[model samples]
Target: MQSQNELRNLLQRIDHKSYPAYKDTRGSYDFGNYVLSIDHVQGDPFAAPSKVSVHVRGGAAKFPADLYRMKCRRLAVCDYLLRQFGQELERVSFKAKGSGKSGLLAVSRPGQEVLERTACQMDEAKGDLVLRFEVGFPANGRTVNARELEKIFFTFLPECVSHSLFYKALDEKAVYRAADLAEDQQYIRDHLKEQGLVAFVADASILPRESGVSGRPMKDAVKFTAPESMKVSFALPHAGKIQGMGIKKGITLIVGGGYHGKSTLLKALELGVYNHIAGDGREYVITDDTAMKIRAEDGRSIKKVDISMFINDLPNGKDTSAFRTEDASGSTSQAANVVEAMEAGAETFLIDEDTSATNFMIRDELMQRVVNREDEPITPFIDRIRELYEQYGISTILVAGSSGSYFHVADCIVQMNRYKPQEITAFAKEEADRFPLPEVKPPKQAAPTFERAVRPDRAFKEDARMKLKTMGRDGISINRDTIDVRYVEQLADTEQLAALAYFLKYAEIHVFNGKRTLRESVSLLMQYVEEHGLAAVTESSYVPCGLAMPRAQEIFACINRYRRISL
Candidate 1:
């Protein structure tokens, strides 16, 4: 139960050999006596918060684990001082404090904006916590005032709380105490208790500017490795914020109700894609090996497109007189855009399918082709995107409505239900078995009694037929005492039928077929009769009062069953 103040005092009491002071052009201190030195605490003599440097007594001596412990202890002291006294520590510096270790831990206050940047490291051996600060230096060897250094360090050191310094210092030692903010494991368990999810705060560190650059130019590979996995919520706002789903590759879907910030999140990702170089303001730790941007061809001005002629008709009208057509129309341009992005060496593709032309993407004929594998257009394009990620190496992030055929093909589903102070939850079917929601059980049958019942002839047939006709006209169709038509109409195609079936089974809706349920099945059948020019079938089958025999017979069966069940 040692307080941070006690911890700092204990850490500073560790052994240190003293040395002598050497006066310079400006005022100087006896830093040579100490293993660490406080150098230039602040830019100006009047600035608050001190900037300190740890100068190894002989530049050749090493401190290895002791240096690590010292760094952690110092961080804890700074955090404790800032929190307790409202004074900030501007920066800390250390280099090769250990005999053979290679690295420096330089902590500074760059700005509040630095907190938003995600820090990742590739080599733990070379990893160090870097802090960038804006400071002024003397033109020559002019001395910086001690008061100013102290003021600057005290003023800004509080910002380091985001680094979780106090607990990390305790982590340096093997001590299990009541932590104000629990370790990642405890934090995860707490979140699981509250929201049925366990999110870990992987590794949070500071990014080094020099480490990622190759020579003077930025390297093509934007590599980042985190020491641990970060736990993120599933219901947070996705706009311009990085909500880590912890997914590495393959198709990831960002789904949610409209106006939930899916598009905004995609835009943020787009910005990252274009500005992925190290030290860039919008750089992100893209550990996925490679990434690329994908967008529909809505307003694009294509100069030329190379496409095969066999799969489609050539434009024959005046529009073609001005430009060459790829598939008889400009509607299929979105597919062409994806193809081009792939050809351009995109390892990851981002697609928003709403902008894709209906004729090319979702037409019944085209859908059938995609479903049957007859002529894979969009399906082949999607399949190739996956194949490239798996075989040739490519990944895709596709954004579309929650209700679409894409769900069938998506490897991961990230639904952004509502915007708030929460994080988005991403579900991977392969990693978890939340797929195909459990089926709804039938209504519990009433315990049987020892009574025999009989029904009258033609009981309630006319009333049932009239009810079925009325429901059918209003777009409700019922079959087998279950709702079918309304849900079926909501479906885009048969592929999404499984989801609807899940709804029927679990949602307690009626099921007519093995699992198919329609609210107004008979009515839908009647409407189908009318649409298909089968009015004569209805007229010829009606015995009286404009009632068709087949329709009447179906109604009689349903009504009789209802009566028998009621009895």
Candidate 2:
């Protein structure tokens, strides 16, 4: 370990030298308040910023163990502190300048969703908290601007760390409140299954987004209110005696006219797996952690997913039992999505009519009568929605605008009228009785087999040990072959997509064998994640600030969409 003065002296010694001189600063320094570690130095200021970390331990930061005792609460605190640190960095960032990206300071900025990310992590048992970020080392073209760099390491960073990481210098009440909210959020999650509910939307919760492009809540949007019939209450550990609309564990239908809150409410439920920031208005809006937002994904590749239960008896004699498709139609793609999600252990499915294939969703009586059962190979979701709930114990919360066919199968129906939800199960049931649902033949299989002999293409393995990157928030590039996940709607951030990319790479290197099933492999992959955190997925064991923990469901989605996946 080097002292802060020693670092200052070394920087002064290397002043006005070539850019390579900055590499000497890549080491640990004890700076009284925190130990700063320069993990990796960029070759040039124009390149990506250097990887850096700051460590605070031994009661130096003053965050309590009790507050971070639970993993959820720990993540909440980390998210809060990371944002705080980012704000502090904004104050001093680029204050000292040189050439290219010189003197720039940044961290992985968090969004509305509170995901467990690599930006910051704390081990309460060891009293160790580490914040990882990036810095653009000061340089004038190819020459080292060590004095400017010195200001960053010795001055700006210390002030930022002191203000954000330490409990004494921070907003104590806000910190505790964040921790408390996480506890309450976690409590609701744990109790949802016990309460026979798949999801809950808190009263006065804002479901509408600011715009199509933004995830932030719409300003002064109509608050959600549950009808008396659907209203249920939960006494959370921290926030006592809260009331909300409890979506029971069965088939739920969100029905309304255009521009109503049907899809908006479903959107809230789609992201309900994560805990929101206090003022995000969807704080208490939570769904089953295993919930998946499934939709039709045309042109997606499928490898040996048994979509037989949903779509069988193909005209071309292709096997639906172990289905394989390079370019699937909308109906077949949606079927694959459902099976893949179920394989990922999804207990609840959130489907929007806008995104789903109409034929896959339902067949009207007129169409059914004209087409006949023998000619039709696909069994629309309407037929299996009830059996799926009763036999398999899987639940569905579908947003339907065009069809009331789902009303016959739905256990609970909530009609969104002008952005307010009113329980209309009785009304829907009466209306549905007058209009009888079409008759359908059930599938032969009880449940689709998720097990498959999976491996990477032989050519891919020889060419590259690992080559992958997240394509923004939409897809992933694996050995130049892309896995399109644009239709995997619940993907919250690009950081989570990056985590999925690494997870797939990790799975290929560590977990995947010729024999392990998709479910088994992903289970093993997620188990490793649970034990070691997202940092373990980095092949080199280097912690990266860019990763945010993705649910096992998204991991399945990534793999299912991979073009190179072979059986």
Candidate 1: where are CA atoms >4 Å away? 1-243, 274-290, 298-304, 308-331, 363-391, 420-567
Off by over 4 Å in 2: 457-465
- Candidate 2 colliding pairs: none
Can you give the lDDT of residue 59 in candidate 1?
A: 24
Model 2, 1-567: lDDT tens per residue? 999999999999999999988889889999997999998889998998999999999478777778677888888999999999999998888998988889899998888999999889998585589999999999988899999998999889998998899888888899989989988998999999888999999999998989998888899899988899888998988889999899999999999899988988998998999999888889999999999998888888888878888888788888998888799999999998888877888999999999999999988888878998778888888888888888878999999998988888889999999999988899899999999865566766767776686785565456546676888888888766778888788899999988898887777766777898888888898888888777988865357878898888888888877777776
Best by TM-score: 2
The digit string of per-residue lDDT tens for model 1 on 1-567 reads 223333233323421211011111112223222222233323332333233332222222221222223322223222222222222222332211211111122332211111111011011122232222222321112332223222222323333322332333233332221111112222233233244221211222112222421112224422222212323443322112233324445666667778664553454344232112223322332222123444333433332233221123233322211223323233444544444344344556655555445544333434454554333323324324444456655567766663354454566566644321122323344433344422222222221121222222232232323122223311222233332222111111221222222222211222122222122333444454435322222222211111111221222123222211221
